[model samples]
Target chain A: MTLVLFVQHLANGLITGGLYALVAIGLSLIYGVLRIINFAHGEIFAVGAYVGFFLWRVLGVPLPLAFVGAMVGTAAMGVAAERLVFRPLRFADPLNSMISAIGLSFLLQNLILQVGGAEPRRLDPFMSGVLLVGPIALPLQYLFILGLAGVLIAAIEVYLRRAWNGLALRASSQDLGTAALMGVSIDRLARVTFAAASALAAAAGVLVGSVFLLQPTMGVSMAAKCFVVVILGGVGNLPGAIVGGLVLGVAESLAVAYVSTALRDVVAFVVLIVALLFRPQGLLRGA
Target chain B: MLALDRVTAVYTGRAVLHEVSLRVAPGEIVAMIGANGSGKSTTLKVITGGLRPVGGQVLLDGEPLEALAPEAVVGRGIALVPEGRRVFPRLTVVENLRIGAYSRADRNRYREDAARVFELFPVLAQRARQEAGTLSGGEQQMLAIGRALMARPRWLLLDEPSLGLAPKVIDVVWDAIQKINADGLAVLLVEQKAFAALQLAARAYVLENGRIVAEGPSATLAADPRVKQAYLSF
Candidate 1:
């Protein structure tokens, strides 16, 4: 590949990695505190896309408003899921909660399939046009995704560092008993975490739906990829998730560009295996 | 002003504390001494709402703390410095202390309370920006207590405050606890280091096999033959 082609592929990889980070960060955050691997997280992403579609196409809302509506809608779904499903299983074995999450995932996937049918759907782009920088041509949609992901991730980092509720969330993730003793309400924190995670996933969903196509099974592959990102980064480490996502995205993009398009899907699993072999603690050390 | 009246707590269907009753009046320092696995920590668990008592009642200021969660217990002005000094390992010293005030409605008092903690433990202030896990065992213990104090608790439930610390370090911790108590904060201390705890506390209770075996003033307990034989070695 020419240098320009390589740079373009790298840029595309970085953008894809950012989206993966967005989804994986939510999974990692929820897992860090709740100790439950939310199997249904990808389904929540799908739900977000559907919400965006309905708001834009049927309700005639503008794209940007529909994006916000999708995020809010998915956040509500996440809060409800925590209250109805996860909270009840809080004290059960981690395996039990994890299994419950799997069941929930299947239930949600099938429900969406029944409602929206098996056909894939697409969302209109929020903006149009591209920018050319020398030999590289960059799509405006990709740039928009990159910028939004950067802003959102930075906002979350700031909130976790500076906000009161965010501090409580971090404290509870470290030591729930001690956190509670310090007056951090575990129940409320759980709800907030769910909302935050779902919102991130929803944003990714809306963005991806605009770029690609949305289907019921879309979450399955997305979930698989994000889980790999989570493991590659470190299970409960937020920074790890971000780095892991980028690494996986770049690896896949490079493989597709330099080698073969058929090898794109295999790249994430290969990286995950390599990571687990060398650094079971993850690329970053975590709880 | 916290009371556990005939509180019975269980772990996995086995009783850890059976009919355990204890009280700390306003600003009183009460120590509960016991051998390992004798339910000292379990009693604190009941008071802090970490474990629900299978039988009996826990009261704060004469009001029953029935089915209240741990955070609610903190809202009622009680904080537990759990055993093992479980400070957030990844968080900075200041962040850990800030989280202690997580339930406070008045955010303005946080700065003042944090300053008070720094005053109590100058070392913690020195390491304010450092991660908590990097602290020595003694400093971590101090941080645990300091973090609890950030809650501005009416009563502090301390579980094994001096565990795994050197004798010199233990003295510093004990002195800090006494100083905290002197400031009109009630303390419910659970310790396997019976001798030092008795010396620091006004009243003491001894537990064996989850039952209170003896109770009296600290001086009287120190002199008691049974207490000395079981706990006061060296």
Candidate 2:
């Protein structure tokens, strides 16, 4: 491939990886504290897209408001899922909770399919036009995705480090029984985690829906890739999820560019296998 | 003041503590000494709300702590420096200290509590930025106590504070515990080192096979023939 084409593919990979990071970080956060793999996380992402679509198209809300609406709406769904589905299963085995998540995922997808139909739906671009930096032509939408993801991730990092509740959340993740002794309410922390993770996933969903298209099955592939990113990064590590997402994104982009499109979906699994073999602890050691 | 009134705790349908009763009056340092699997730790768990009693009640200042969660128990001014010095391993010392104040409503008092902790363990102050996992075992134990102190607790529960420490370090820990008790905070300590616990506590209880076999003033217990024969061997 030409140098310009390679750079273009690199940019595409980074942007796509940003989306993956957003999704995977949420998954990792829930898993870290709650110790349950949220199989329904991808469905939450899809729900965000539909929420954003309806808010923008049907309600004629502004783009930013619609984005917020999607996030808030999906966050409510997340809180509901935790209270209604996961809360009762809190003390059960991890496998039982994970199976419940899978069941919830299927239920969500079927619900979406019945309401929105099987056809893929598209949203109007949140931005338009392109900017050229040297020989590379960069789309504005990609820039928006990169900018938004950067802001949200930075905010989360800040909250985890500096805020009191965030510190409690981090502490709870490290040692639950001790954290409780320290006066960190595990129930409230779990609810906050679900809401935050769901919001991030919703943001990714809206961004991806605008750039590409949304369908009931979109979450399946997205969830698969996110799980790969989480495990490759480290199961419960936050920074690991971001790095894992970018690496997978860039690798997949390079695979599509230098090899064939058929190699795109296979790249993450290959990396996952390689990571499990050599660094089962994770690419990052701990949270 | 904290009291366990005939608290009987079970694990997997088997009783671990059989109607254990204990109390820590204000400004008192009380110790519970026992052998392995003797349910001393289980007794601490019952007080901290880590485990529910199958029978009887835990009371704080004569108020029932029956329905309170662990954090709520902390809010009522009870903090547990749990066994194993379970600090947030990845967090900085200061961060871990701050988390101890997680349920506190007064931000200024939290700051003051942090200052008091730093004063109590100056070593923690010097290495405030270091990850807790990097601290020496003794330092980790100090951090664990310091973290509990940050909650501004009226009563403290310490489990095996001297579990793995050098003699000099254990002295430092004992001194800190005594100093904190001098500040009017009641303490309930559980220790495997029965002799040291008896030396430090004003009163002590001997637990064997999940029952309190002996309870009296520490000095009297230490001088008792059976207590000396069973626990004070060189």
Best by TM-score: 2
Tens-digit lDDT string for candidate 2 (B1-234): 688889888998899999888889989999999888999988888777778898998988899996778778889988889889999998999898889888788843676788889899999989989999999999999999998888888999999999989999999999999999999999999999999999899999999988999999999999999888888875
Q: What does the lDDT read for residue A33 in candidate 2?
A: 88
TM-scores, in order shown?
A: 0.96, 0.97
> How does chain A of candidate 2 score by TM-score against the true chain A?
0.98
Candidate 1: list runs displaced more than 4 Å: none
Give the alpha carbon lDDT tens digit for every residue of A4-113 in model 1. 99999999999899999999999999999888899999999888888888899889999999999999999999999999999998988888889889998999899889
Interface RMSD of each: 0.9, 0.8
lDDT by residue for model 2 (A72-191), tens: 999999999999899999998888899999999999999989987899998878799998998899999899898899899998999899888888888888888888887777788888
State residue B182's C-alpha deviation in candidate 2, in Å: 1.2
Clash-forming residue pairs, model 1: none
Over B133-190, each residue of candidate 1 has an lDDT whose tens digit, in order, gives: 9999999999999988888888988999999999999999999999999998999999
